[model samples]
Target: MILTEEIKRIKSTEKEARKFGIQVGLVFMIITLILFISDKGNSHYFFIVGGVLIILGQLFPQLLIIPNKLWMSLGVVLGYFSSRIILFVLFYFILTPIGIAAKIFGKNFLEKKINIEKKSYWNIRNNHYNKSQTEKQF
Candidate 1:
């Protein structure tokens, strides 16, 4: 998706980029401050979590640290199941082998079109149009 105008404006200008970072930092500071003003020690834990997320978002360490495309792709897939450890384990134990097999064997599988639903090619100038489906097979 294309960025909205406001985001594009920030992305286009170095000055705006600094301003954006500062404003985002201020937002984090405000949250931390509010947490601190109410209670001190709990907020410090929040600070650690917020800091890690911010740093990761700032520098996407995934592209550097992961090292392998397969492993990176695995991490990206596992990320969806991060919240549920059991599902992640199940996927690791069960579906991973199937996926590997698919990668190895399914590469040579013939492409077949099973579903065909015919519709008009276009709407003509007046009210009706001729319909045809020209299928090209590899």
Candidate 2:
């Protein structure tokens, strides 16, 4: 049977998840080793756990499915919140001050005008194009 695009995508995701699990397991093992070398009391317990994780990740990556799903879900949630906060900071702190400064300097980028006596709101522009400009066809 021919594999669908979604099936291919899911296979790739599973592969990546396996890699992520292995990497996390290695990191934990490294940290445990460091702690052990430092003569930390709880290092043995962490080392045992990290060794188990490394073995599981290497031999039975399927067992990491739940943990992988949970990690991905947490990343998605954190990314959503962090992106909103970053955008809010950029707009409020950076863009707002720039906009206020532009207004103070009488720089109307939007070309807004306040005139009570104006009959029409249309600001007509000269649409006349020269022969050389038309020939360019940009």
Candidate 3:
């Protein structure tokens, strides 16, 4: 039973990978068409490669396994590095300058006040409420 389930999973994964390969081939073909339309040099190579990919993707998709794996690995590595760079840019270029400017201008967004002489940090407010105030708490 376990072997059967594993086989099914593997079959499904292969089917999905085949579909992905076909999609990638179609994209390459589309790029080739665009390049041809623009009359670019070396387009014949792209056309030949794209045609071969499409044919292989349709006939023997298993042959595309290595290329698919390499593409997925590249995407993973690029995604990790791109996300890190984007976050670094956001925090360092955007938020860091805003924080420094706020510090220089004496702007406290969190409303935190520090006093060494104060024993308690809590401030007590009046709790007396009328009936109308209780009815509309917001």
Compare the candidates by TM-score and give the number of the best one: 3
Q: lDDT of all the models against the reference?
A: 0.52, 0.74, 0.75
lDDT of 3 by residue, 48-67 (tens): 77788777778888887767
For model 2, the superposed segments whose C-alpha errors exceed 4 Å read 1-14, 33-41, 109-138
lDDT of 2 at 99: 97
Q: How close is candidate 3 to the true structure, as a TM-score?
A: 0.71
Candidate 1 Cα lDDT to native: 0.52
lDDT of 1 by residue, 95-115 (tens): 888778977886534434343
Candidate 2 lDDT score at position 78: 75
- lDDT, residue 83, model 2: 86
Q: Where is the poorest 10-residue window by lDDT in model 3?
A: 3-12
Tens digit of per-residue lDDT, candidate 2, span 63-123: 8777776676666667767989999999999999999999899998976777789888797
With candidate 1 superimposed using the best TM-score fit, by how many Å does residue 45's alpha carbon deviate from the native? 5.4
Candidate order by lDDT, decreasing, is 3, 2, 1
TM-score list, all predictions: 0.27, 0.61, 0.71
Summed backbone clashes in each candidate are 0, 0, 0
